[model samples]
Target: MDKLIKGALQFMQEGFNEHKNLFENLKEEQNPHTLFVGCADSRVLPNLITSTLPGELFVVRNIANIIPPYRIKDEYLASTAAIEYALYALKVQNVVICGHSNCGGCKDINQEKAKLLPNVSKWVSQLDEIKQQVDFTLELNHYEGQHGLRSWMIEKANIINSYNNLLTYPNVRQMVEEKKLSIKAWYFLIQTGEIFEYCEENGHFMPLGEKK
Candidate 1:
């Protein structure tokens, strides 16, 4: 906690001074262009990876970057509410769901470890559908002993599932249909710091800058 406080103080002194104009301009409002749904992993820095500034991304971080399928209930819907605000109020033009390699959340989903944490278990229940898909793929590919490949596929599959869940929102669907919104899924290679963007027509994620 002390280290975090020190960093906050340092930011207010040196870091904030550097971006004073940008902060001042955003004092009253923010118009982030993208809603970045990413993992709560300490290692995955969304802004750093994307070369984006503070106000450029309205970030939603969770166990596995999980965005619940849009639904209404008596319970609080934190993820859904954030998405709604980003789309309706902030009017973000793009939604980026980023899943990283070696994600602990993905590993937990596969291993059924999230059950230990009651809230996390409920939250990550959304991954069960895709988790089964991964198991089926592993069975067909015989990747049982290949832990790395298993995790790699699960992480990417989780990202694609998040994109699918995001569409469950009526507003989001309407926005996409009208071309007012764009949704993208990304796989981040933690070891190499490379990002692959999903191409729906091509049916897979390709290197970020390579032309199809």
Candidate 2:
């Protein structure tokens, strides 16, 4: 807490002073170009990772960076609501679903750890589809460790799954079909600080540098 306060003070004094004009402009309103949906993990800093300024990317972070499917009944759903606001309200041009290697939420799904956390149990249960995928893969060929490669695959798969879920929103689907909005799946290799962008052309994730 003390460290965070000190950092805020430093930012107010030094950082804010340096970017006074940017901050002043943002004080009136914000027009971010991208909507970044990423993990709540401290390791993933969306702005720092993308080298974006304060008004460049509107971000939504949650456990495993999950984007629940579009459901009208669930009016106050956090992620879904954020996606709607970013697309229809904020008018962001791009939506990026980012997942990282060795995600705890993915690990929990594989190890049945969510059962211990009642509230989180239902939330992370969204990964059940991926869990089934991993189980089917393991049944064909079992792995060594408890999680091992299966967990990693689940993490990456969740990114694509969330991206698909994003399209379930009527507005999002319309925008995408009309070429008004685009979606991208991203995988961040935490250990190496390397990010991969999913390439729909080849159906594979290529390094950030080779995205073209």
Candidate 3:
């Protein structure tokens, strides 16, 4: 708590002073171009990874970075509401679904460990269809195999699943069909500091650098 407070104080002093104009304009309103849906993992900092400034990327995060199919119900839905606001209200041009390597949420799904958290277990059950669709060839059987190829495939598959879900929203589908909005899937490798962008044509995630 003290460290957070200290960081807040430092931001008020140094960061605010350095980017006064940017902060001033942001104070009035935000016109972010991208809606970044990602995992609520401490290691994955959206703005830091994208080198984006404040008010640039509107963000919505959740465990496993899952995007549920759009449904209107009496219950409160956090992620769906955020997506609706970003797409319909804010009119963001791009929606990026980012999945990272060694994601705890993905690992949990792979191991079927949601039983440990009752509420989370119920919530993540929505991902069961996708989990079932995951290619068994990508499963890591042995300890040595776990650290190699299979891990990357799991991470990439999760990103693709989320991206597909993003299209399930009626508003998103309409906008995408009209070419007014675009959805992208990304994989961020924490260990190597490399990023891969999904190539729709090739059906593979290639290095961002190679794509450019």
lDDT of candidate 3 over 55-101, digit per residue (tens): 98999999888888788999999999999999888899999899898
TM-score of each: 0.92, 0.92, 0.87
lDDT of 1 at 26: 95
Report the lDDT tens digits of candidate 1 across residue range 134-195: 88888898777677887888788888888988998877788898999999899998999988
In model 3, the runs with Cα more than 4 Å from the true position are: 109-116, 138-150
Off by over 4 Å in 2: 109-116, 142-146
Candidate 1 overall lDDT versus native: 0.86
Candidate 2 lDDT by residue in tens digits, 1-212:
99999999999889999889999899988899999999999999999889988899999999899998888773468888888888888999998899998888776633455456766777888998798878788777856355677888889889988988888888777888899998989999999989999987887889987987
Flag regions of model 1 displaced more than 4 Å: 109-116
Error of 2 at 122 (Å): 1.0
lDDT of 3: 0.82
